[model samples]
Target: MATGFYTHPDCVLHEMGEWHPECPARLQAIEDQLIAGRIDGLLERREAPLVAEADILRAHTAAHWDFLSANAPKSGYFAIDGDTVLNSHSLTAARRAAGAAVAATDAVLAGELENAFCSIRPPGHHATPGTAMGFCLLNNIAVAVRHALDVHGLQRVAIVDFDVHHGNGTEAAFAGESRVLMCSIFQHPFYPYSGTENPAPNMVNVPVPARTGGLEVREMIDLTWLPRLEEFKPQMIFISAGFDAHRDDDLGGLALTEADFSWITAQVKAVAQRHAHGRIVSCLEGGYNLSALGRSVVAHLRVLADL
Candidate 1:
């Protein structure tokens, strides 16, 4: 089976501002590169449906939902936090972005697809159950994990986050949960500085120093993360694929590159093949510089699409 490319139109409609790095142009960049690279032939494309309220409730509390829906601006932008914002179309886009992950997870686990990629935003892995921060309105992957366990009856799932910034929200959601194992590497002393402290037993937090380059990433995966994941023998794997760690991106000062992204994807693919029958669902998290972001995503997706 082919990999699934999950996305939605509303994802392009939501914008924080003209100057935001998480602009709609980010989507256009990936789309243009995918077309230019002729990647369309390697995957199965599908439109993301709006996630049901029941699915959303799996990760977010009812009170949190009520606050965000009630505070959504009708005509202009409203700030959810210092870095997070909501426009008129934010709610719709948030739902669809989350739904894309849900669809990808379903497709991968149900044998409809070998693997899947969700190309939507505002990027998740930052929003917690009660708080929406770091430009994230809803924790997309967290919701997908809940759906997989609660809805699909999967026992163990692993989430691998490689964002330049720590996935504080995802960690918050599954801190004590034994069924889910989250292994991640992020820049240290960065925004939302919480991962450096005592992490949950199942959470493996690798805080790479700024400018650690791709070599360090590979070492971490080979030495720290991969072994734990293999021992866990998770039934499914989810990735928070972030490109901001690329050398060209100044967002977090990490020195990773496109080749590094491909290498990481290959590692994840191997892990899935070993433990989960090649079941994997990856979602976009962050990547700032347009040229770097486009190239990094292409490299990552090339592995996912098996091209």
Candidate 2:
């Protein structure tokens, strides 16, 4: 089966501001690169459905959902934080972003697709259950992982977050849960600097110093993440795919390149093949520089689509 490419049009309709780094153009950049690289035709594309309230509640509180929806700005933007904002279409877009993750999970587990990639966002990974931060309003990957564990009856699922910043929100969701093993590598003392502090036994969080290069990142993953993943033997693998770690992206000071992203995807792909019957679901989290983001996603998808 072809790899599933999940996305939605409403995701592009929600905008924070004209100059925000996490603009709707980020999605357009991915779309352009996919067409330019000819990877668009190699995959199965699908529109994302809006998430049900129950799905969002699997990882977030009802009050959290109620607040975001109730407080959505009708004409302008409602500031959730110094950075996170909600416009008329913000909640709708967030629902689609999260729904993409869930639908992709269902598709992968049901064998409708070998694996799936969700290209929707108001990028998720940073929003905790009760707090929305780091330009995230809803924790998309968390909702999907819970869907896999709760609805699909998967006993064990592994979450791999490779964002430049720590996935504090995702960590908050499943920190002590035995059924989930969360492995990550992020720039230390960075934004949402919380991963290094007493992580749970199931968490393998490697915090690299600023300006760390791709080779060192790979070595850390090999030394830290791989062994734990092997031991856990997850029934499904979910990736919080973020490209802001690329050297060209100024949001992060890391020195990773598109090749590094591909290498990481390949490593995760091998793990999935070995332990999860090749079932994997990936959701986009962050990647600011348009050119770098688009190129990096294409590199990652090449490995997934075997192009």
Candidate 3:
């Protein structure tokens, strides 16, 4: 089976503002790159269904769900935080954002596809169980992980986050959950700084220095992430595929190139092959520099698609 590509029109409608880096243009950039390269032909595309409330509740609290649904504006934007905002379509978009992951998870777990990619937004790695922060609103991958665990009864799942900033919300959501193994490498002293400190035992948070490039990331992957993931023997792999660490992006100071993204994808694929029957579900998290983000995603998806 081909790799699955999951997305929804609602995701594009969840705009924060014109000036926000996490604007509709990010998805447009990715689509432009895919079309320019004719990359869409390599995968099976599907529109994401809006996730049921039970799916969101699997990873987040009822209160968080209620707050997001109730607070969605009828016309203008409502700020969730200084950076995060909710517009009229925010709730619908959040549901589809999470739904893409759920669909991808189902596709991979059911052997309908070898792997899947969710290309929706409000980028989800930073949304906690009860709080939405860092431009994230629903913790998409967390919802998928929970669905895979509860609905599919998977014994183990692994999450690898390569965003420049730490996935504090994802960490917070899965802190004590032993069923999942979350590993990440992010630039230290970045926004919402918390991963460098003591995290839960299930987390392998590797904090790199500013301007750290592929070599350092590769070293961390080899020396740290791989060993833990191998021992855990995860039955599935979930990726928070963030490209903001690219040298061109101003979100953080890490300097990863497209080649680095492909290299890391290959490494993660090897681990999945070893323990998970090559079942992988990847979701977008962050990437601001349009050109770099577009190129990096092509490289990452090329690997995920096994092209």
Best by lDDT: 2
TM-score of each model, in listed order? 0.99, 0.99, 0.98
The window of 10 residues in a row where model 3 has the poorest summed lDDT is 189-198
Q: Least lDDT summed over 10 consecutive residues: which range in candidate 2?
A: 73-82
Error of 1 at 231 (Å): 0.2
lDDT of 3 by residue, 1-307 (tens): 7888888888999888898899888888999898887887888998999998899998999999888888888999899889999999988998999999998898888899999988889999889999999999999999999999999998889999999989998898888799999999999888878897778999999998898999888988999999999999999999999999999999889999999999999999999999999999999999999999888888999998878
Point out where model 2 deviates above 4 Å.
none
Clashes per candidate, residues 3 or more apart or on different chains: 0, 0, 0
- Candidate 2 deviates by what RMSD? 0.6
Write model 1 residue lDDT over 90-196, tens digit each, in one string: 99999999999999898888899999989999899999999899989999999999999999999999999999999999999999999999999999889878798
Query: For model 2, how does the per-residue alpha-carbon lDDT over 182-254 read when each residue is reduced to its tens digit?
Result: 9999999999989998999988999999999999999999999999999999999999999999999999999
Worst 10 residues of 1 by lDDT: 34-43
